[model samples]
Target: MRESYSLLPITELKGVGARLAEELEQLGIATVDDLFAYFPYRYDNYELRDLTDVQDQEQVTILGKVQSEPLLNYYGKKKSRLTVRVLSGRYLITVILFNRPYLKRSLKLEDTVTVTGKWDRNRATLTSSDFHIGQPDQNAQWAPVYPVKSGVSVKKLRVLISQAFTQFPNRIKENLPKELLTSYKLIGREQAIRTIHFPDGQANLHQARRRLVYEEFLIYQLKMQAYKRMKRSSSDGIRIPLDQKRIREFVGLLPFSMTHAQNRVIDEILKDMASSSPMNRLLQGDVGSGKTIVAAIALYAAVSAGYQGALMAPTEILAEQHAENLHNLFQPFSISVGLLTGSVRGKKRRELLENLSNGKVHILIGTHALIQPEVVFQNLGLVVTDEQHRFGVGQRGALRLKGKEPDVLYMTATPIPRTLALSVFGDMDVSTIDELPGGRKQIKTYWVQENIIDRVIQFMKKELDQGRQAYVICPLIEESEQLDVQNALDVHAQLSQALPGYTVALMHGKLTPEEKDEVMNSFKKRDDQVLVSTTVVEVGVNVPNASLMIIYDADRFGLSQLHQLRGRVGRGNAQSYCILLSDAKSETSREKMRMMTETTDGFKLSAYDLKLRGPGDFFGKKQSGLPSFKLADIVHDYRTLATARDDAARLVQSPQFWQEDRYEQLRKPLIESGLTQTLHLD
Candidate 1:
């Protein structure tokens, strides 16, 4: 029964008909079990409050008698406002309702009703968007609000949930073992699921939340542990020997001296590459922190050992940049660098593949096209990826399989907090290049109102007058292309009108690749003194002379994206500044702006972002190509994650644990969740 629980359709439940089921389906509730998984995003405290204790702007539930008949006032063609003057002892407060004329039938003179809303001090009225036709204490202690669609009403959803719980009492089975539940001080899984939708009391709701959070985190930790074990026990990796003298010569000839952090990370990678076991290392660094330099060292090591190395980038532009950078770095040592991407085709691609397979080409850099079946390496020793999060775990695995025991290294400019690192990249060793090279000036940042456009333009002109380039990032707002194109054109027109003497150009994703390249190159060469572009510039368009960045509609972008955009500047020696222009007045937007201006540390901001927006918003919902966890939240469930990680490690060590009957209920869910794919143990 528990194994096939999710297969039971919502239509089978009482009070849920075909039409109602269709409405519920809009919220992704097709099965009876999906309703259980759809936990409340927040709870409304409908607990009754005394009239005397109510403060201005406080949401409270007041039980009062209507002093006079409810008057319905009509204004515009489709608009109506209902005013009910309610009396509670000696105090009188008006209940204002918008577009709800039907309430006049239920609420009459002397009718007692419960009102829950915010008290408006200026109007001295209780504006209620939600109310109940009952005594206050008779209602549920806590009102759970599920994520709703446009047509679905909260009252109807609550009724359906109550019916499902009542009719399917014994159908829900307890999943966790009794010993495990007792040890963790958790309630039964069946009770937790029931309480989550409609809690008997506050204590049960907290207990239920704790149980579900632990379950989600434990399964994730187990998957990570199994992946780690498989890599250690796998026999396909080829060990590459590191020569100290060869490395010293390569480092000595470089134009700029390597920072201590870069050198330390290189040393760590060298040690990992030298080991017989396959290397899974994540290289994290802030923008312009020399991550590419560390990756270059590993590629050289692979080539020096008579092996081929592959570097994959998220976009063709980045791939081209890496190809150019690596070619310049390796040409001094006579190592051939080849660029392979989806665009490289026909005879040219065929020749590159042949050269790559025959050991003639020492290094290959490209986009996802490098993972194609036809592209084989003679002695592939290292696999490196820039913008590693862009590729899913499956894509990374596919690349890792290309060579025997090849070392896998990933580099990212977006700093990931350590807590997230342990959950997402738990299978890999972590390396961080946290320091900038000596004498690099800190980029000053500011968050300003949209009205300060003239001042920002004046600042950009001052920078351009000194022959420095500036980037005005036009947000590629998640809207229609016509709107985005119009925004770019509008901003371009404004900047051009403002700074009439300077050259201004526009770029966006809608532009052809050739057009984008042309515009980027023009900006890079200072032909276009100021370039206005969308977030496409966030990846790898490095122009050191560009010291000014103006982000329009800054509130629309996430903290991580804003950080990456800020990184575009501050690459050169001159002091740089980022101007974040936004008119959004929400608290969340204000907090994001405040954090951006307060600090320049990417890691600190990353941790703050994780807490502010949870894992999904910090990265995307499809982060690292990882699927969404149905129940766990990385920010709120950190302690549970830590415990789960330790428990998973210990559980895998117990060879007899999997053979026991106590964990029988966990098998189907774990397999269906895809956690078992990472676990190689039969």
Candidate 2:
């Protein structure tokens, strides 16, 4: 039978059998292509070294003769050791392998072998546990380190990978044009793959990385360009011609005057509404920047023009919050409003659908459930999405499809850097709400040590005694039973004991949705004097009466998260405070914590975070399902990404490239990588 590329089991390879194939499959290596893309996380260099040149603490491979038989020693109930002596003519050194008496039988006195490991020096004597004895010139030079699981060793995986690479067919097509390679001074694909696996030198590795990084970013830029072109060509809903009088009247009725930044963004959105094409825009602002009010004005414009509008939030609580806020704001204007979410069921949901279909609901607010097939709109004109980063591009597209080519306004509270915004959201027009609403007080933030817990509690009690509310945030829901930090349940217990007179309520993810809602509702009504909870309350549970927020283990959270938590307080007329508690002693950790104390500006905090911890660490691995780039450091390589974006725009503008066969191979890898999904193309 002819061997198939995928149908043949992995055991068909030289050293693999059914059992080994199953083991390889457990590592997500089922086919040749999967193995090829599974790049090493890091490499260990094992270049040969002479015995005379072996230095302490340096990882080296040296060949020496065993001068004495290994000796075994046992000192404690659980401790055992094996000691071997190695000699190189005039010099001698003792090699100690701890807790492995079997090594005494594995090696003979006169045996000559090569050992690979790092040499350690203690009181002028060198020692190392990171050593492995092997035959000279047979072991790997630059060993690839894979993330090992149970029953797997780095050495064993290295052997398997080396064998796989040898037997695997070189089927990768050259996707980058030769001209671009020459212009960018990038290595070829074949060279990059080989050098990345077994680099001859640091310079070669760097060159390989540069080529790969550029390719990754280049594809991303290409997709953005395609999306931009596609959006420009798509048909738009009827433009709601701007009515300055109506807008001004709405602005006059607002409780506070619009900030200069808010007015600018409003003007930008108005211009988009009056344009010939649908608006694909993003409204980025810090927490409490009044983006909702601006969205309301846009919705009013759409409704006044005899069209409908919709707003989508990431969570049901946030969606409900938006609906309530909009309903209250539009109440005086007599504008109809409706709310729909997954939790809304039975007759209410059916009635909402009927109202939305009949255009009785001028503005609609809901979670992703609003995009369901049953929910349809009459002449939907504008779509606004809150916390846009929380939803994927596909989800946004699904929501947009609810309307007839409706204008889109995506909003994010997390302030993305200008460079990153350009790279990530390049296809969309960007507007930032850089100003806070008038009369809004800046939150006073402080970092405290654990020893100040009593003082903090006393302050909270004082606030509660004054008829104000407070929120105490814990990192975990239940007591971990193992970890030393406070949890929601434990904090609730302690606080209940500490403040016997105040009513304390606890909420966490472990609670059922109904239970969570009950707790949140009780806290919102100020029925509970103190609310102790986990990060479940992080996004959209607003309690204007809550004047203080105390977050334990504040060092465990990212800067953006810290800012979001701080935003939970300082929403009402009260002078609010946020206390961050941490036990960290490192200066870096202190400085990171201090960023919150120094500023309440989300953008400024993000900038500081980007500097302190690079973008990769800020979001962490598997952050929101963003594509992980093997080569590009989004923080450090901003200039390169910008250049790539510009180049992609220019290249895509050439109709010949999009129409010609020349770019087919160039676009194939991008499609295969699943990065093109963001572009809304097949």
RMSD for all candidates, in order, please: 5.0, 5.7
Scored by lDDT, model 2 comes in at: 0.78
What TM-score does prediction 2 earn? 0.79
**Model 1, span 276-368: residue lDDT tens:** 878898999987789998899889988888778999999887898899989988887999999997778899999999999999999999998
Question: Which candidate's lDDT is highest?
Answer: 1
TM-score per prediction, in order, is 0.80, 0.79
Clashing pairs in 1: 236-405, 237-405, 238-405
TM-score result, candidate 1? 0.80
Across 1-682, the per-residue lDDT of candidate 2 in tens digits comes to 0111223446656777777667777887776555555567787776766656666677666667888888899988978877778874455777766787777778887787666656654422335445555555543566677776756567777676567668764554566777788898888876787677667666888898888788878888887776676666555555777777987898998888888999999999999998867899989998989888899999998887788999999877788788888899989888898988877889988898998899888898988887788988988989999988777677888989987778999888888777677766777888998878878788889899999999999888888888899989899876676766778888899999999888999988877766877888888987888989888778867788889999998887778888998899998998999999898678877887888898888998887777777766654434343456766877778778877888787766765554445666665554554434334322
Q: Would you list the C-alpha lDDT of every candidate in the order shown?
A: 0.82, 0.78
